[model samples]
Structures are given as structure tokens and as C-alpha cells.
Target chain A: MTDTAIEAADLTLAYGRRREPALRGCSFRLATGRVCALVGPNGAGKSTLLALAAGLLRPTSGRLAVLGTTPAAARPRVAYVAQDKPLHPGLSVAETLRLGAELNAGSWDAALAAQVAADGELDPGARVRSLSGGQRTRLALALALGKRAELLLLDEPMADLDPLARNRLMGTLMAEAAEHGTTVVMSSHIIGELADACDHLLLVSGGRVRLGGGIDDLVHAHALVTGTGRVADLARHTVVESRATGRGLTALIRTDGPVDPAWDVEEPSLEELLLAHLRAPDAPALITPGTTPTRAVAA
Target chain B: MVEYRIDRRSGVATYLQIVQQTRQALRLGLLEPGDKLPTAREVVEATAVNPNTVLKAYRELEREGLVEARRGLGTFVRRSLGGAPADTPLHGELLEWATRARAAGLDREDTAALFAAVLEEKFPQPHAAPEQAVPQPQPPPERTLPQPQSVPHGTTTEGDPA
Candidate 1:
């Protein structure tokens, strides 16, 4: 098994000569056999990152590796599930799986493919256009899994899935990871769901990673403290988010080390932490250079 | 042979409900080592729940070593409560939480109180049965109390209404 499924160093990507870079100086490594969630707001270059990782688009600068080999060289071992469902409307579910198997230069076992389809709760005869959004997503995942790729790059795989479907897909993905040691890097907007399913999280904003680490580590590093006393007057060790609250100045603070005894502290949820990033003033300026401030990534 | 009872009315996520049910089944010996589990689709069909709920439960079970997935076969019960030992992910999560609480300067008493509150909120105690198996009537009201007026910050309330 490869030590690292994905590694990028000082990567910069752009669409056109004059177009601003979609991603700038982004660097991170996703270890093999781990589920890593890439989270950011709309147009934060998440799709571009996946494309570069999958070798669909080459980085303008820096380096990238997928499964111990450059993405372009490891095309057979790397599978890219694009943000949009890339299914052919005229093809049936089985046909689509067959196409994936053929493209990957792998054998397509009818019985095994049927079993996977049944497991995914997809009808073999159902046309791509007739399937619901969730079904389409499942079918896409099934196709990817059937290809037996070493590294799976899923772009917004759970965007259209319902809560239950999302859970099931996560289970399937986890099983795949454990059994085959497949490396999965999936992007998602649902921070809480990702927190529960993924072990590692990469928080991206303005085409760069603001934070990347194990989920437990991030939660332990930050806390939400509520108190009756003035938070600003206590000390400068804590980074106070806000001082005004209906219930006596509840503040979400990040402690430099151990929390002080004066304030009551509780661990903030992933959503709260993500919101803090979105609420920051530099969030808009972080993305594009000259354009007007667009939607904040954290919110 | 594991039996699961789901409370659809509860606000908890369905996957969490399934996880609790599976754990209870293992504790009760309803499921044993090497027992074959219903497929995700079958569970969804039988329970009339989403396939994802069953999948999520199975994923948690796999993480806990309570279940294993056989490629091209299906999920099966791996070990019983007394089988080979391994530190499940949930245990790690609990330990992480404890460390965080400790780092936050929370004492044993504070941690216990917080845990008790969480338990009460997540799994409330059942009310005792009445003689008629129905809710008891409330006692008659003794007197009406007026709502207290809001006081300004640092304002003296001694001279106000008693």
C-alpha cells in the first residue's frame, strides 16, 4: 500500500492566462486508508483541487502525487467522481458500471456487478435519467468502487444525498477503506456529518488550507466559554469571539493552553468552528485578488 | 437473531438509533459471533428506513469490531461481547473528550455533572406507573404569583416591589 494517497506542494491552478488562480500555494497530504473531508464554501476551488489531484487539470506550479505516482501517470489506479453525475442518460446502471470497468482496464464480472448494484439499492434496468438524485449519486459511487481504484477522489459526493443515503454511502466507503485499503478524499459541505464520518479534516478558504488535522485535535484546541463576568477583562490568553450574548456574555474562545479557572468552558461543535472562519473579515479577501468580496466560505 | 426496536418519534438521528439498537443486541446476546447480518438493502426494506441508516449502523459496528464485511458476500457478526479485545473508535473518542475536559480545567465533579445532564437529555428516566396506568392529576393551584419586573443593571431592588 502507498504511504500517502495524495501529496501536493505549493500547488497553483488556473483556467485561463488572465484568469486568477483557482488554487494558490495549496499544500497537504492525505494518508492512505484514511477518509479525509475537504470542506470550503462555494467556488473555494474544491472542485479544482480534486481535478488537479485526479490529473484532469495540471497545476500551474508545485507538485502533486496520487498513490505514489503522479496523477497523470497513475490514471488507472486513480478514479475521479466529478461533481456532476457523469452518467450517460441512455445507459442503464449496469452499462455504466461496465463502462467504468472497461475504462479502468479491469474485468467486469456480471454477478459481482449485480451484487454491488443490489447492495447500492439501484435497479440494474433503471436509466440514468430516470433515477433520483440520491440514486444517481449511489450509482456513481458503485461505479467508482467497482473499478477497484487505489485512490478515490469524490467531489461533493454527498451533496444531493439524504441523511440516510449519506450514512449508507459513508458506511460503504468506510468498509471499502478497511477491506481494500482504498484511499478516499471526498469534499463535502455538511461539516457535522463529515465530522462524524471522517477521521481527518482539511479546512480550506481562499484557495488555501487554513487548518488541517485530526478532528479531536481541533476540538480540543478550541472551546466555548460562558460566564457572568466580563470576558475581555479576565486575560489576553483566550481569543474571544464575541462578548455580548443574551445569557450573560457567552463567548467562543480559543485557549492558548489549558483553560483558565475563571471561565466555564465547553467544546464547540465543528459547525461553530467553521462558522468562526466564515465570520472572519479576511475570508472574502482570501479567495480572489481584485474581485468584490463574494460569499464567505465558513458561513 | 438480534432484535431491534426503533422509536420513530425520537429526534435523534436514525443512524444513531440503529447504533444504540445494535449495541444493545450485542449486550443482550441476541447476536453472536459469526452470525450473518441482513444486507443493507434488506435492513432498509424490513425497517422501512433509509439504506444509509442501516449502512451507518453497520459502519459503526465495523469500527467497533462487532461486525465484519466480506467482499462480495455481506456483513457478518465478527465477535461477541467477550471476544478478542480491541480498542474501538468510540472508546478513543471518549478518551479524547476526557482529555479535552481535563485540559479545560474541569474537575471530576464538573465532568460527572455534565455527563449526568447529557445522559438525562439523551435517555431520560422512565416515569413510575400510576394505579390506573394513566398520568396522575395535578394538585389544585394555591395562589397566583405576579411576574417580576426586569431590573436595570446595578440598580437597587430593595426599595422596589416586594
Candidate 2:
């Protein structure tokens, strides 16, 4: 098994002639056995990136790899749950499970799939058309877990579930990672939800990866400093965002070293760091040690 | 097995919360020596937290000599935090004292404030250095009313004019 779960180098993908590219020159590496959060604003190419990694969509330019091989070759070992969660509307819940079992045959885990379905109290006789949005999500997740794939790529997996179901499903996902060392990358708009369950993060914006690394490392790499000073005073650090508070200038800086003692420095929270980068698109990006690909990208 | 309730808004790191909860359970005699801690899988499955957070907490507990992990078996409590056990005479005495305080017309908040003040005076810094023992000075025999030191919100003596 490869140590790297997913690696992309200068990956670019375009839709049609009129619209901007979905992903443009995006690159990052996700290590195995990590629960990573893919977060970005609308049209930030998060879904496009996941699709590219899943072999469902091809990039217009640049390279992408899944499990140390081409995405197509890694399909059997990877599970991708699309945002729309397409399923046969006519098939009964039981029939859907049967179909999954048939498709994945030798590697399918029937008991695990059934347990996931049962956790949601999904009825076997119910048709897919009859299930609620949350129920369909539960069923989709059941198939994903049942496949016993090594890497799970989920796009906004918790968007429809109620709070209790969200918690329960998250717990199940965490347990799977704990036991089998599965690498999971799930995208979500809720920062608090992701903060609790994810140790690594990929912050994509404007078709580019703005931040990618271990959450703790990324948070520690920058400092939130507030002091009575001007922007010129912060010339030494890479300032992501800065605003003038009533008493002084408060800024988020990717620290070069120990910040000057004149400014009171504290670590920015994950949300604050993401928001700062998202607000200032031109800030120099910092891809910490592990998240960088072993092979350098061709400019 | 002890279940952890994670408060996302608590401002406490998730792993630290786990360690604090386990230590609290030990001090209260809820988790005695030889009791097995819930596996990381079980904890993450129930709490919806990342599995690493749970493992990190357990590793910290192991380093403190509060728990031991056997090769194949799960982690077990090695020793309990030293304090007055729940069913001991000290607890009974505290209960009686609480009853007297309530009868003396102190509201729950007032009593809590008073108790916390006394605890602060005695413990000084309960969490400063759990591993290192600090020599404590004995309290005087003649008890004087602990005029609850100026409370944070400055509402300690609000209702009573006396």
C-alpha cells in the first residue's frame, strides 16, 4: 500500500468555453490514514477536485494520482460519493444493497453495509424514491462503507442529515478510520463540524488550493497579532489579512520567526486562518512539509 | 466504560477534555483501578471525534502513569487520583455542611461561590502541576467566615445588604 493517499500537481480542469475553469493549477498531497476536510467557498472547485481524484472527471492539464497510481487504476480501491448521490430511484433498499454486493462481489462487506443502513432505521422494503433526503444520504453512505474501499472521497456528505444522524454517521466514519486506517477526505461548508472530525485540511478557493496541511501545523504556522502599529510595521511577516481595530492594527501573519514583542501574538483558530486566506486571495500560500508532494511540479 | 461529552464551544482542546473527564471519573471513584478505558474506536464512534484525539488522550494518561496499555488487550486504569472517595466520611461531612449552608438561607449560587472560595484558598492552583506535590500550610483551628473574596463579576454580596 502506498503511503500517500492522493497527490495532485498543477492540476487544472475546465468545463466549457464560457465559464472559468473548475480547478486551475491546484496541487497538494494527502497522507494515508488521515481524516481531511476539503473546504472552500462556492465555485471554489472542491467538488471538481474530488471528481478528478475519483477518476470521474479528467483534468484539462496537470497530473493527479490516487493511491500512488492513476485514478482509473485505483478506482477499485477508492470509493467516491458524489454530491448529488445518484441512485436507482426504483430499486428497493434491499435491492440496492444486493446490487452493491454484486458490483463489489469479493470485497463487499454485507454486514457493515447493513449495519450502516440499520443505524438510520432504513426500511429494506422502501424504494429509493420514497426515502427522505437524509435517508438517501444514509443509504449512499451505506454503499460507500460496504464497498470496503481503502480511500473514501465524500463531497459534502453531511449536508442533508439531521444533527443526531450527522453525529452518528461521523462516529461511524471515525471508527472505520480507527480500525482499518482508512484515508477519508470529506468536504463540508460547516467549519465547526469539520474541526471536530478532521485532523488535516485542504482549503481550496478560486480554483486553487489556498491552504493544505495538518490542521494543527497550519494553525501554528500563522499568528494573530494585535498591536498599536501600522501595516508597515508588519513588513517582516507574510500578512494574510489585516484590519484596524479601534485601539490598534490586528493582522494574521504567516510567521517568519518569533513575532516582534511589541505586538501581542496568539495562534489563530482554524476558522480564523481559513477565513483570512479566503478573504485575501493574493496572500502567499504555505504548504507545510508533509502535505507537499514528494515530486516537484513542472512550472 | 466512561462516555465523553465533547463541548465544541468549551474553548478547551478536545483531547484535554478527554483527559480531564477521565481524571474526574477517577477522582470520584467512578473508574477504579483495573477498569478498562473505552477503546479509541468505541470513543470516536460514540463521540464523533477524530480517532487520533482519543488515542492522544489515552497516551497522555499512560505517560502520567494513570493508565497502562497491554500489548493486545485494551488500556486499563493503573491508579485512581488521590482524594476523598465518594462514600467516605469526608463526603458525608461535606454533605452535612452543604445542608447547613442551604438552611442558613444561602442560595445555590451563593453556596457554590463560598465553596469555590474555600477550595481556592486550600488548593491555590488545583491544575498548576498535577504531577508535582506542593507543600500545603495547615488551616487555623478557629474558623472564621470566608468572606468570599471579591468575586469576578462583583455580584457576590448583591442580595444581602448586611
In order, the Cα lDDT scores of the candidates are 0.66, 0.86
Q: Give the alpha carbon lDDT tens digit for every residue of A33-112 in model 2.
A: 99999999988999999998999998899998899899999999999999999899999999999999999999999999
Which fraction of the native contacts appears in each prediction? 0.00, 0.62
Candidate 1 collision pairs: A164-B52, A168-B52
Give the lDDT of residue A74 in candidate 1.
Answer: 80
Candidate with the greatest lDDT versus the true structure? 2
Q: Give the CA lDDT, 0 to 100, for residue A147 in model 1.
A: 75
Q: Write the per-residue lDDT of candidate 2 for residues B1-23, one digit (tens) a residue.
A: 89999999987788989998998
Where in model 2 is the C-alpha error above 4 Å? A296-299, B87-162
Clashing pairs in 2: none
Kindly list the per-residue Cα lDDT of model 1 for residues A1-299, writing each as its tens digit. Answer: 45777777777888888988889987666667666778888878889999988889988887877777778888788778999978899999878877877775643334544554686688878899999887888788777777777888999988898877666666667666655666778898777666545656777777887656655455555677766767664465445365567667676655555555555666676678777765662532221121112222111
Give the residue spans of candidate 1 off by over 4 A. A107-112, A119-132, A229-240, A281-299, B1-162
